[model samples]
Target chain A: MPASKIDLSPHNARAYLEPGPIVLISSRHGDETNIMTLGWHVVLEFSPSLVGCMISGGNHSFRLVRQSRECVINLPTVDMIDTVVRIGNSSGRSVDKFADNALTAEPALRVEAPLIGECYANFECRLFDDAMVDRYNFFIFEIVKAHRARRPKHPQTIHYTGDGDFMVAGKIVSRRGLFRPGMLGNGRS
Target chain B: MPASKIDLSPHNARAYLEPGPIVLISSRHGDETNIMTLGWHVVLEFSPSLVGCMISGGNHSFRLVRQSRECVINLPTVDMIDTVVRIGNSSGRSVDKFADNALTAEPALRVEAPLIGECYANFECRLFDDAMVDRYNFFIFEIVKAHRARRPKHPQTIHYTGDGDFMVAGKIVSRRGLFRPGMLGNGRS
Candidate 1:
């Protein structure tokens, strides 16, 4: 783990995930470890810090995640755009994603899945529900632990717009005054 | 209804929604109509154009959408950030969101819900599956029709990060050359 990274409350995962950046899902089963780029995900809840990820059935990581019932959601910044694309372009079945991409795999606090040290944030997740997995390939996971960089309050995240295009995170704008006091969950208002 | 808007294929809905922008969902039940701001949503599939939205049961629009089983997901650009926040802060039960926000309620082609004329795009959706709704407040909708502005290929969409703050959509980056031919669903590659 990087010294610059700090532990974060799992409940505050929404602050980093709600923006919908493309994330890398790292998983492990027995001796095998894999990483896959994923964008089809949503922040489902805050208290338990639940997130829903739609992993395609065809992805090699699917079997690993389904078998282990756990994975690490890694948030990569815009600086890792090329690496992100490359990770998404290749398959983890034949090549070891960590060694192939030259990404550092760091130990996570709560999950067996390793976290990508290059990512700005890493959320350790446990499968909370598998009810929708058979039908939609949607796995609802509860984020049990979170780690993020201490500096750069807002990192430039990359959002996939499909068809090989990406949208970078831009300027931050606040409407704290316009929000109802009860609606501001983070207490920043 | 605007001259600048054009009909789009339902499969192409990912081009507008995959980026994870905060969207305005318009719903109608009987004679009542309501609009609510939603950020918890994910693109579930492409061929059927499925989208999973976790609409909190407490929201006023929840009942309207649940009863009607239809909605118009309106994409509001960065220019409409204030309106988006205001819509999210207020309740549809007390205010006529369309009239109070000064947004035009244009009739949708496939759903009874009216589309926000000021939005960059509108996707008419019908509830595809309700199995997860009771357990997760998640509604799986299949986009039946889509409409978007012809110009300004990339709209500056706003993404919520809790605590009343928003991140606006920034520059457009493409890695067409790096993508596998089969992965480029839009045929641009």
Candidate 2:
């Protein structure tokens, strides 16, 4: 099922939807810290490890990120989908997200934002730039430090397919020896 | 398999490596057109759909995109991995990508760029803003028009894992009736 062609209406056009695991981004400003679910993000570069994420201007976390300029991107596995959805539905602006979600905060190495102990990997990031914030509501970041389970703790990560559905990442298939170098070999984070 | 933690070396920390399908971007300027595989991209908004992607200045397509300020983001499936990798490996400045790879070119709706016939979906995008392109090498685009197969012809699209490996999207599981109004359904493109 590779080359068949069919025209799709604009209303139904789903191009590259969500691809990566949903992340729990923790932000801090002053004495308050907030946690929220983030699915709109992408890796922007390799060497400096840049990432671009979209945070609605209305979200409470956006304000915190603006003030603190730091956050932790925590990757949740498939087992955490239900909790992820719950977090996504709830607002971090009103409640103590950590207590409401029963999540733990572990200190990060380089950023003030704490890591989500429950997730598989945590990237302690510092805001790299925010030039597009006004027009696109996007934030550019650099992973100042990162952590992961030695062996995948929950390798079965889930990607949201709008309408409260998901697609679990399965089986590893490499195009062995096809790499052209410059790629980080053991992508630890 | 959830609580174990390992400190990943910063050099190997690839926190959010592959979260979406790798796309082949088709760009044209004047009489020159080029195809380049892109993985560093993410969705930035829902309505008036916005996308953020990073294209290094070294790539030939970047020149075309800079001149045209328009492109088609084509989503390739698992079956097109080889071709995708090949296109990624070769430079568009010297070679005729379409002839070498045997990819088809179809007219687009809102943009001057042509769609890749083998791709599962094509988003006709226009460069909305390029202010951050200098410092971050990021391009903010808005999907002005889109098209997709009525159904996911290759439901199993591939995500590029660093170092020539990839992860295939597998198994659909949705949370029925959980979506609030306004979420895109059966995302066609």
Strongest candidate by lDDT: 1
* Model 1 residue pairs with clashes: none
Tens digit of lDDT per residue, candidate 2, span A1-189? 001212222111111122466688899999889888777787766557677788888788999998899998877887787777777776776888888888888877688888888876677788988877887778878877666654452266777655456778877677756657753253322
lDDT of every predicted structure (CA atoms): 0.91, 0.70
Distance from true position, residue B110, model 1, in Å?
0.8
The alpha-carbon lDDT assigned to residue A64 of candidate 1 equals: 96
Question: Model 1 captures what fraction of native contacts?
Answer: 0.87
Candidate 1 Cα misplacement greater than 4 A, ranges: A187-189, B187-189
lDDT of 2 at B182: 45
